[model samples]
Target: MTDWLSASAMLLAGVIVGAMFLYGMRRRQDRSDLERADLEAKRDALIARLREAPDPSLERDAAEVLRKLDKMGVEAAPLGGAAGGLKPAATQIKGFLWGAGSVAAIAAIVFFVTRQTKPAAPADPLADLERSVQQNPDNLPLRDDLAKAYLDRNNIEGVSEQTQYVLQRNPSDARALTYSAIVHIIARQPEAAAAMLQRATQSDPNLVDAWVGVAWLNAQAGDMPRAEAAMAEAKRRHPEMAERLDQLMAHLRGPSKAEAVHVTLNYGGQARGMIFIIARAAGVTSGPPAAVKRLPLSTFPIDVDLSAADSMMGQPLPQKMRIEARIDSDGDPLTHDPKDPGAVAEGVVLGNSVSLTLK
Candidate 1:
């Protein structure tokens, strides 16, 4: 679209320039014609004066005027000769050359503009898959392949539409359900994602990806126990993935330590709420947190352990840290809602339990 607009502007500019050039040329030609006619009239008047009075002074004046008219290329009255025909022929040749040059310039401008305005070919791999799916409407495998392609491209809308179509045909399709859950995760609706993943797992107990998805979502949502349980189930279903699962678990749980902090929380009469325990490097308040843990308000005065597994990815837990316990009613561990009541205790060292009261 941009290219087309540019080409159109260029074409319009060319037309305006051409019109101005032609107008200037025509005006110049008209001026030249008027100058020639004026010179001829002056020469004819001088000749008539010379013929009427044969005085020496008048003849000299007429001679001077004739010389000036010759110098200016102004022809006298028609002698019915070849010179008059040749003058028009020369003018015609000049006009033709100018017209031809102008045409050539316009052609070059058009050619360059067209080349620049041409759109490049699109590079979409899903085009073929979509066409195939369209042709084979009843082909479940083809539809699933199209949905996977959409997922790979991160086209959440396309993925949802395709997966929903597949689910309508087969609600128990584990792969489709998992794909839908992934879309929800991308949209930051972890609860919706967990529900879909749970359904997928129920449909197929051996779906390792579904279990892993559930575990990751649970961990992100601050439900560590459920995350660990899902990871265990995933590992149990496929022991070959134990090493990978162990790495994931370590990342989620953080590093182990001989001593840990046991946080005692007083929720101030709030019976059912979510508590997030985060440990950050002392005095560092504006970056990736050191480690995080999610707990229930009902479980007050619980033993809390801050380890490397609880640490965020790529950020290790600091030896000296500040611990904070937030009582969040929304159940989101990462976000701090102003309306939710929480508590903070800063500058606390590791390997020691800290008690915090939530008002």
Candidate 2:
């Protein structure tokens, strides 16, 4: 008879090696599955982000996610096949001695590990707001909150997009219309801004922003009385907006002096291109002007006011100024066509008027 001891040794060794190999494969598969699950979760998050607020980099990130998905496709293959060149009795004894114990230990370990729960992470306020907005696109209040959050973060485009969607669904939405008006203001579309603000006020008379916006628009158009009236009515109706309205009142009133610079331009030639009225701090030879005004050269001998309203630096109006008047032949300030007519008057006092001639 063949040595039973030798056969038993080989059988035990084979069982141990096979058990180790199988365990390693299972561990790898588990890790791969976990990775795939994590990737899928991340993919879903990315898709949500893209839907809410997308940028150029998101496409690259999405492509990378797809590439990773192409991998981790290992099938759960069942370990199979009968023992060959080994005595059945020896194999049975080996399995009984080691395989059952090993399996039990692994199972116990796995069970304990899986039972331990990970602590939940803290919620992100912005992300939570975004998710809420995404889930309920019709909810205008939530969208407004989200838009305010975006504005806090200086995300103007995001705010605009949110406002646009809300307005598209409900054109009469007061808050959305106000936000759209603000967007138009940023885009330098004063007419559109005025229209939107008017709609907002008509839609909801209680909206403080609509009234405040009307005030601001009127103030910008040199209609101080109307601006003050609108602001006063808003403050009377919504006392809670007093602090903000007060600040706006200060801005609209401008400097305490409200000094004015009256200019008379004399050009004999027919108007062409444009004219620029620039005022700089007196005695400052080379630098940016404190205030500037540009107007079409449709008519010669133009009369215009240059004041703190047209200030470029927000610089307090100096006691004295070096005022300049330039008529560009090309209508472009960046270029000098040599034929441009210009005049400079040094040491011009505030509230003093000067008549300039193009020679």
Candidate 3:
């Protein structure tokens, strides 16, 4: 942007300089013509004086007029001077060059200064969004958008981070679990893949994809009975989704593929208390009202270990999976704040939500 402004300033300066130089040249020519006319008038006055009064005083007066013409820088012949008007001509030439040079220098300085003062161009919105996500990875809405951005760019690293973020919220998140399982399976980690598949099933038994996951894991292990059983269960639960599930299973069993894998949510990393991981769909738009299940972290300072790579499967995290940690205070939790809402930090990222007291 700065470069563009500089170029534009240069073009404008060139145009302005050209115009001023042309005008200056014309003005100098006009001034020269006026001087010539004045010199001619003085000469005619002297000739008339000599014709009318042939006096010595008149001759001396005409000599003074000629001297005044020389001071006025009129480049004309003196009445009988040996050297013509060389001195006045040199003065006019020097003055014009000095004036033109000064104008050019001033124009150049103005152009550069204007260019320097111009504002810079705007930043990329997507790049800004990515940076925001990196700084605050636990922001689910931002993370979701970032995940799609990574998908568009085919950036596996970004995809992994975003998927891990979703899992951090709700370890049992079906989409996250499914993607994580796919990633692990492609990396030849059948045990890890099976674990995630089991997590998805526990979160939502109706999710046929989870059963497919189990089937794929079992098939890779040469356990056809468990594999077939898992497939049958998937068919029974999701009759409509059976065909697609089979296609997916077939693809997973194909030739080996490289994958960028990451660990599941780590529940033991909970700082304050037992942290919960919630996983929502990759692009979930809206959720239910503020119940214990869908409570925003602002109202409740839950110490959810959001960045945990593994999730506890003994119980379901949450149906919607927004809150991660419940910082179990020693006593009964506070209900309301007396001061300003802005003074009390509400729903920020989980990292900022850690505290034993409301403050």
Estimate the lDDT of model 3.
Answer: 0.52
Which order, best to worst by lDDT?
A: 2, 1, 3
The alpha-carbon lDDT assigned to residue 357 of candidate 1 equals 78
Error of 3 at 28 (Å): 5.7
Total clashing pairs for each candidate: 10, 0, 18
**Candidate 3 residue-wise lDDT, 200-319, digit = tens:** 888888876568667766765657678778878988988888787665555434322111111122222223322222233223323321212112223243333322112111111222
Assess every candidate by TM-score. Answer: 0.42, 0.42, 0.35
Model 1 stretches with alpha carbons more than 4 Å out:
1-171, 176-208, 214-250, 253-264, 268-299, 303-356
Per residue, candidate 2 scores C-alpha lDDT tens digits across 236-307 of: 999988997877677566644347778899888664777878787898754545666767776767888776
Clashing pairs in 1: 252-309, 253-309, 253-310, 254-307, 254-308, 254-309, 254-310, 255-307, 255-308, 255-309
Predicted structure 2, TM vs. truth? 0.42
Query: What C-alpha lDDT do the candidate models reach, one value each?
Result: 0.70, 0.71, 0.52
Ten residues in a row with the worst lDDT in model 3? Answer: 255-264
